[model samples]
Target: MRALVTGANGLLGSNLVRELITRGHEARAMVRRTSNVEGLAGLDTSMVYGDVRNIDELTRAAEGCDVIFHTAAVFSYWGYTREVMMETAKGGVTNALDAAKAAGSKRVVLTSSTAVFGGSDGPKVLDEHAALVEVGVPDYFASKAIQERVALEHAAKVGVELVVANPSLFVGSYDYRPSASLATITGYLGDPLKITYPGGVNIIHAGDVAIGHILLAERGEPNEHYVIAAENVTWREVHDTISELCGVPKPRIKVTRTPALAAASLMELAAKITRKAPLATRALAEQTGRYFWYSNAKIARLGFLPRSMRQTLTQTIAWLLVSPHLTNKQRAKLRPHDDVLQAMRQAQVAQRLKSVRIQDLS
Candidate 1:
């Protein structure tokens, strides 16, 4: 099968493209000309230059594809306005569907985030049937919710098969720029964290999420949603895990939501004054106040069992430790001692790389 992956340079897109190639599919990587392709190094991919917002370019790229893996989106809490994000988010989905519709693709696997489901109060496991929780929605979640609805509606009206894979906070290797979630990890590893919020994250391996996409395309019913995640862990748990793994001291200060929000407000104010993006925005603080937990039972029912989060963290830390992009200063900050990082690198070197799924479902 021939596949076209939008945002092919992104974390999930890069993983999906590798899976496609491993399955012996011809991968047409559709990315902006300026997007980094370092993650795609040595992969047998047919690179196409185009923006997801461009219907004509996307259509040209999507032509002659068996499936369209649409994973393109702008994921920033700052540095761009809601209007700009809305246009790109909404237009991206619509344009991808249009291209898939024009190309006569058999299926369209759209990678979405759990942000669309909003926040849960506590240990409740949310499924796709849960309606969008609108209270305290940040600009990023709003754009994503709108984008997903637009994509689903477009796919439905056009009679195209669309499978939505909603993955929670992913942690694994191949994070070139190290995604926002990974940034939180590395930032804390670089320096002992002084404070943290009170929320939870459903962490999943990126490779597992990529495989979940393939399972969705192969057997998932059209117009259905799959919650793809590994486990639900609290912020404290995450911090403790990192501390234990990297030999860093955990932050003793746990700020309540109100105080965190105040800190975020101050940060945002300082950011505006300094003309730089805030490390912790009000949106982030509010999000951290609630649990981003979900049930992966739906995808698991389709034989999608993910590796443990600790295993994922080991790989993630190892990748960051050895990354060519990591500066000497950054490495020193992250490595309070050499063994902390050296051990992870050695462990990763001992393990074999992940291979493609779907092709070898036996």
Candidate 2:
């Protein structure tokens, strides 16, 4: 079988291609023309160059493919208006599904995000049965919900089977860019995230999530959705693990949801006048202050087991520590907070002791 994956150079896209090749299927990767091709260098994949926002650009790329994995969407959270974010995200998915239908692709798997599931907090945890809540959700989350709605509606009209896979925050190696999740880990391990986050998160290895997509394509029910994720952990738990592993002292400062929201609101107002990104935006504060934990029992039923959070953190940090892909700025940002400070102090004391010893010997 031949499958086409959009956003081929991105975190999930790169891993999806690798997963497809391992399953004995031919993979076609659709990447933007200007993206750095280095991420896909060694992977054995047929490269298709096009923009998902344009249907004509994707028509030939989607031809003869049995399945289309629509993983391409604008995830821009900061410095983007709601209109721009939705237009970019919705247009991309619409074109991809249109291309799939026109090319006679039997199935198309849409990569939606668990961010679409919001405000589902209470006695029950969220799952496929959870409703899509847009009120108070970030533009990114609301846009994804709209994106899914449009794609499914279009798929139904075109006679192509559409299956949706909603993955939580991804963690694992092969994250050359040290994605948003990796960046968050580094911030905690390094300079010490001064403010405490209120909500918890579910993290899945990106490779596992990639394979989940293919499995969904094969066994997933038509027009049904699956939540692909691993462990559900709180922010404190994640930060504490990073501190223990990196041998750094955790920061003592903590900020609760109420104060954080007030601060973010003020910053949002300032950002509007400055036309610059805020230190804390209202949308970000609102989303992070809510629990995003999801149930993955549905995907696990398909025989896809994910790695433990411990293993995921270990491998992810190990790679980031030595990867040439990391900028000096990124590397410095990841240096453990107390470890470096202690090292400098110890060196200063040793220097003074050496001078005293030299005088005694004289």
Candidate 3:
């Protein structure tokens, strides 16, 4: 199959492109002029330049592609105005569908976040059936909800098949932006003392998410939403895993919800004063102690398979070792953990070999 992937330089998009090529499919990677394509290095895919907001440009880029994967968005908690973020979200969908129709693409697979499933303070599992709550969700999430709605409506109106893949927090390679989760890990690496909070979230490898997107295109029902996730882990568990992987001390301080929110607010205030992005954001803090757990059974019906959290984190850390997003100070801090990182990489290789042997035996 030939496909066009927007935001092709991003974490999910880059991995999706790699997965497409690995599966012997052709991919046209549509990225902006200024996008960093380091993650796409050595990938055997055609590169096209276009913005998702421009229908004419996107149409030209989508030509000859059987499937159009819309994965472009302003993925940040700060540094973007609400208007720009919302426009990129909702407008991107409208343009992508239009472009799909204009280019005669068969289907458009949109990448939405699991944040659309309003999180709970407790461990309430969410699925695609959950309703999106707009009362107090972050702008990023609200925008995604709007994007999903627009895609569903527009696809039906324009006569284009649409499938949505809502993935949980990603933890795999090709993450050039490094994602917010990876940024947090980098912060922990920079500081010896790790701090934890009472929050939980679903984590999935970006590679598995890429597979989910492809499955959605191939076997997913039209207008269906699929949750692609691997593990639901608490913040403490997340930090502990990283600590073990890096051979560093585990989180020693557990900040409760209220104080954590306060800290996030202060950090945001300081960021504004310093004209920089904060490590933590109030939007994330507002979901403190909430369990963003999800069930991927819907996608499983389509033969979707996701890696374990350990496997995801292992690959992520291995990538982080060479990621250019890391600061010099952060790299220096991580240098001492080189032995631990190498050991983890070797163990991952052995585990994969064992899994392959088991599969062959079966």
Candidate that scores best on lDDT: 3
lDDT, candidate 2, 1-362, per-residue tens: 79989987778887898789889998888877676555565566778778888798787888889999998876655777899878977788778878988898889899999888874343236898888866677788899898888878888887789999999988665566435566566556545444456568787778888989999988999898899988888777777767655565665666666777798899788988998756666777765556778889998899878877765665556555555555777666454445434444543342343211000100
lDDT of 3 by residue, 1-362 (tens): 99999998898998899899899998888888888776777666678877888888899998899999999998888889889988899899999999999989999999998988888878889999999765597888888888898889999999999999999988677677667767767777665558877868888888899999999989989998999998888878888888887767889988777887898899999998999888878887777788899999999988988988777777778767665666676665543356447744763453343111001100
Better of 1 and 3 by TM-score: 3
- TM-score of every candidate: 0.90, 0.84, 0.91
Q: Evaluate all candidate structures by whole-model CA lDDT and list the values in order.
A: 0.78, 0.75, 0.83
Candidate scoring better on lDDT of 1 and 3 = 3
Q: How far off is residue 154 in model 3, in Å?
A: 0.7
Q: Whole-model lDDT for model 1 versus the true structure?
A: 0.78
lDDT of 1 by residue, 171-254 (tens): 666677556777667656654445666878888878788889888888898989899999888888887777776666777788
CA deviation > 4 Å runs, candidate 3:
327-362
Q: Cα miss at 134, model 3 (Å)?
A: 2.0
